[model samples]
Target: MSNKEQLYQERLNRYMTAMDCGKPDKVPVCFGIGEWAIKYTDYTFQEVFYDSEKANRIVEDMLPDFDVDIFSGGPTLWWPPMFDVMGSKLYKFPGIGLEEDNTFQYNEEEYMKAEDYDDFIANPTEWLVKNFLPRISAEFAEPGSYRATIALIKSSAAFAMFGAAAGAAAQRWAVEYGMVGQFTGFTKAPFDTLGDALRAMKGILTDLRRRPDKVLAACEAIVPHNIYGGIAGPGADTRFPCFAPLHRGAYPFLNPEQWDKFYWPTLKAVIEGLWAKGKRMFFFAEGNWTPYLEKIAELPEKSIVFDIDTTDAKKAREILGGKFCLQGGIPTTLLTYGTPEKVKEHVKRTIDELAGDGGFILAPGGVLMGDAKKENILAAIEAAREYGVY
Candidate 1:
């Protein structure tokens, strides 16, 4: 094999071995070129988010210098041009609605109402198309109007174009950079699918008390779709885990009783369903899940790679250790506020604590923001390689 291909295999093996709760030559390190990377370049947030090629080139330039196994993703998450065509009200992209240098902002509203539960439960896809789309898209509100029709066509075309470009970029990263993608498909916990963009936090919280049954019904109805998405649809690869950014399922959002009743069952169902198909969930638990660790351990072995954001890492390793891979060590805040020496110390300490006997990948606990220092990021990677050896 060529040098890049050999490097790719070695990194992939290290990553997969750790995922299966086994030790390899070294602990796999997962890294992402987040919004922080843009600050180092001449580009603004608007430039990278709107231009896929520029974003891809920036990531490509950084890949060769870093010694890491898995890559979480690039500078920006979405291509704003796709949303611009549809007049999407979901987010105010940089330069479009905000200043050129400002990061995007999510405009969360009650797009799905409590009264709409029955129709949504009856036919989720149709409900999203007929009701949800119009609520979120300014140009598509009138549905049959010329502007709405054109918006739909243009948005769909943009989706296709963006998907193609992204696919090509991923391929280039794999072949040229030898980077293993963190996950293949993307999904959310059923409750998050209901709570995040649909009912909105306030609306969902209110519904839990007044219309509990409707909330339950809607979450149950969302299961099959979540599973399909988790696997990236039919015939998609199960080699990599599916990314599931769990939101409301975290502690305090739903009390133990509420979480047990409303969140765990449906979320567990999705994980079990995906696991049955030989797919794993990258359980991106973003907040403190200390109280829920025991409950999370009930899943079938190797069904998840539990991320430690604000979650107790030691407790997670103690409970879910051999059963699942544990990812995240350096907190994003450290990368932003701490120095390179401090970051290196933190990485070394984290590896010493969490990388024992295998089943750990070092990464930032949460998404790195634009403020995260580039030097600290480099230190974390350097320290991981130094201290992460088995």
Candidate 2:
């Protein structure tokens, strides 16, 4: 067999083994693209977004230097131009990261005046089709070698929260208004139309306290769009979930009780809805899901994969057991500061501790930053291949 084919087969074997609750030649490792990559590679988000050929070239150049097992789907936030035309707002910091800024002056008052659930429903498809689809279709249609595996689609609940209309309206809008408006609306909306426009986190919390049923209902309505058969579903091979972080703004202010009460129920509903459609969820629970591990553990087996950041891996293994696959826990901070030997030691320890009975994928707790040391990443991958033997 050719060298490339052999390496590919080796990787596939590792992946299949983990999926089947068996041991392979080694533990498979997956790397996520994050802010660190931007800093380390000094590549612009636009370069990664618009030009797949350039992106692939960069990945090929980097692979020899850092032998990661799985390549990332792509930069997580690659919204098209339609988002801007739909009046979607984006929050940009000098260096930290970029996200949809849903704080709109008009939306705050509108939501406050919305006396009942009916006031929140808006059709986003009209906007999406009229405004966004053309640009994305054009971009993807262009011939390029570096096609990504995963495709992220916006959820109706998320769009509604940010002030974009959902359903046929959003899709029709994308088709009609062209790509600019569609991209804008898709990126800038809230989890559900019920949340506050100015303060999306507070809005969700308030809804959880004041109008939970409405939130639940809204979530249900949005799930259809988030699935494979629906307007926004990314196909079977892709693993993408409608991601919503619990806490907004800075950390430390997150209240666990509030999260369980306000977020968990709705999230559960959304996940279950997607589950029924046969899409496995890769939930990126950014904060400590330890407090709610029991609840999370209740999710269907092999259908949900929890990517815990900064959570206790040992406790996670205990709580989750064989119920669901667990990804992540390798700290990014260590990758930057530690030596190659130290990184290998950490990877070995984590694998030895976690990879006993299967249902685990080794990855950084979050994403590898652009500035992360190449040597450290190589060490992590090497450790997995060498020490993670069956």
Candidate 3:
């Protein structure tokens, strides 16, 4: 094998072994590069959002310095212009209608009417194309109008061109840099899709009580798309594993009785579908799910990684010890404020305890934020180097 290929395989092996509840040579670290990349270059959100090539280059330049096991920054920040042209009710990207320097934000208004729930479940793709798209963007709502049609075509072309370029560049960088955690895919629980896109958050929560059956049906209905996501990706055909970033189904969000009825059933079905097709996943549990420890424990063994957020990951290790490969949750708050020594110390403690057995990887609890300290990020890598030995 070529030296480049060999280096890629070596790192890939560590993550593949780790994610399956087995020990690799050492625990792998995933760089949670979200807004942090934009921040790193000292670029304004407006500056980077407008210049996709420059923004991408900045991230690529930084990746080698940290030398993380798996490279991130998939589908990097390429917004603004499209929203500007289409008139998005969904997001406010910097400069493009949003006041200068303000970071992009979602505007989740009720795009779906309550009475339309059954139509959504019956044909999600058609409903989205026919109904959801039109409601949110003026361009889609008036497709036959010449100005709208021209604007839509131009903006979509630009968005696709940038997305394809960024994605390809990320993949190439991963291989050439010998990082190669090329596994990138996304599947939200059907309920989150229903909440984020259709019912809106408050609306969905209200519907859980007011129209529980429709909510359940909609969640079930979105499962096929979720499974398709699980079963297809760079991860599906290669060593990299597909992961599900779970949102909106944690402790205070839904009571256990409500969870059983609304969340777990559809989510489990999505996971099982992936497993049956010979795919594995890492479920990015996005909130404090300590209350549902036993319920999480019931998932089929060695088929997933549950990288937790806002919960005691050490306790999670004990609860899910051998069930799913546990992952790290380096609090961005601590990383931003603590000394480098303290950051390293915290990471060491997490590594020593959770990875003592294997079935663990180190990762940010959430996407690495723009404000996280560079020294602290370096310390996470240093901790793995110093104490993450098998």
Q: Pick the candidate with the highest TM-score.
A: 1
Model 3 segments beyond 4 Å from truth? 74-78, 233-235
Best by lDDT: 1
Q: Arrange candidates by TM-score, highest first: which order?
A: 1, 3, 2
Over 201-259, each residue of candidate 1 has an lDDT whose tens digit, in order, gives 99999999999999999999999999999876422678899999999988899999999
By lDDT: ranked, best first: 1, 3, 2
The sequence of per-residue lDDT tens digits that candidate 3 reaches over residues 100-182 is 56677778888998899999989999998778877888766776788668767977887787668766876677666776653
**Poorly placed runs, candidate 2 (over 4 Å):** 1-3, 33-52, 64-66, 74-76, 79-88, 91-117, 122-199, 228-233, 238-257
- Report how far off residue 376 is in candidate 1 (Å): 0.3
Clashes in each model (backbone N, CA, C under 3 Å)? 0, 65, 0
Q: Poorest 10 consecutive residues of model 1 by lDDT?
A: 230-239
Q: Of models 1 and 2, which has the larger TM-score? A: 1
Runs off by more than 4 Å, candidate 1: 233-235
TM-score, prediction 1: 0.98
